[model samples]
Target chain A: EAGVAQSPRYKIIEKRQSVAFWCNPISGHATLYWYQQILGQGPKLLIQFQNNGVVDDSQLPKDRFSAERLKGVDSTLKIQPAKLEDSAVYLCASSPRGGGGNEQFFGPGTRLTVL
Target chain B: DQQVKQNSPSLSVQEGRISILNCDYTNSMFDYFLWYKKYPAEGPTFLISISSIKDKNEDGRFTVFLNKSAKHLSLHIVPSQPGDSAVYFCAARGFSGNTGKLIFGQGTTLQVKP
Candidate 1:
């Protein structure tokens, strides 16, 4: 079975510029997540979606970050007026369903470098 | 306050030796814990998991032990291989009001020498 897929694999933008990352989760997966992983740190959950509805986004920077899962199968995370601290890898993961104990499969992630 | 913590930043062990990675969490409501392995330039891959109802779970050469009272967990890999060299992360799932998200700990980098 194919795993989660992410686009660009790498990105670079100026501090004031905007950037977007795309993700396509595994087939038949019902839960999708977006995480920000700074260098030397673990991936931090920025947002989670159960189908087309958002399940959690408390840790997300509401001022500059936003994400959406249009059809509940694919997701996009965007950051506007990016800052240097946002220069981290954007990871996407998905699980079989929105349930505990299910292992999440992750994508290669997009390394965003903001100057 | 950090909910999850991995005190050891790195560990090195010889091939065929046992490797143990420790993680501690402050949240007692976390019911499901997991371990993920990640290589450079790659996203974390799920390695093993344990539920609160159980104290130990094993998968082949990998084992996870959870101590509920202390809110601590450890991942053990026996006869370690060079391929196991990577960063390991521990995550927990719990509900905070209306949201249920996995809280991750700082990773522990492991190197296996031949």
Candidate 2:
């Protein structure tokens, strides 16, 4: 079975420039997530989607970051006015369900370097 | 607050030796724990998992032991192979007013020398 897929394994952008990342989940997966991993730190959950509907996004900086899942299969995460602090890897993951004990399958991730 | 913590940033062991990685979590509500292995430039792969009710779970040469009283867990690899060299991350699943999100540690890079 194919795993989660992401586009543009690496990206470099200037400060204040906008960037977007794409993700395609595994077949029949109902839950999708976007996470940010800074240097030397664990991946932080930014947003979660369950079948095209939002489940949680409390940690997301709505002022600069946004995400959406269309048709419950593919999702996109966007950052506006990117800052130097946004120079980190943006990871996408999907799961069969959005409940406990369900393992999340991750993608290769998009490394965004904001100069 | 960092709920999950992996104190060791890295570890090195001989190919035939045993490797033990430790993790501690501050949240008592975390009911499930998991370990993921990751190579540079690749996504993390699920290694092993154990529920809170179980103290130990083993698969092949990997074993995960959880101590609820101490809120600590560990991953053990025996007769480690060179291919086992990778970053190991400890994650915990529990409801924190949000969906069941997994809190992860800083990750520990392991090097299994030939």
Candidate closest to the true structure, highest lDDT: 2
Candidate 1 per-residue lDDT over residues A20-110, each given as its tens digit: 9999999999999999999878889899899989878888999999999997789999999899999999999998876534568899999
- RMSD to true structure for each model, in Å: 1.2, 1.0
Q: Is the docking of candidate 2 incorrect, acceptable, medium or high quality?
A: medium
- State TM-scores per candidate: 0.96, 0.98
Model 2 pairs whose backbones collide: none
Q: What lDDT tens digits, residue by residue, belong to model 1 across residues B1-114? A: 789999999999999999999999998989899999999988888899999999999999999999999899999999899999999999999886755678899899999999
Q: Residue B60, candidate 2: how far off, in angstroms?
A: 0.6
Listed per model in order, the count of residue pairs whose N, CA or C atoms clash below 3 Å is 0, 0
Candidate 1: Cα lDDT at B47? 92
In model 1, state the lDDT of residue B4: 93
In DockQ terms, which candidate is top? 2
**Per-residue lDDT for A40 in model 2?**
86
User: Which TM-score value belongs to model 2?
Assistant: 0.98
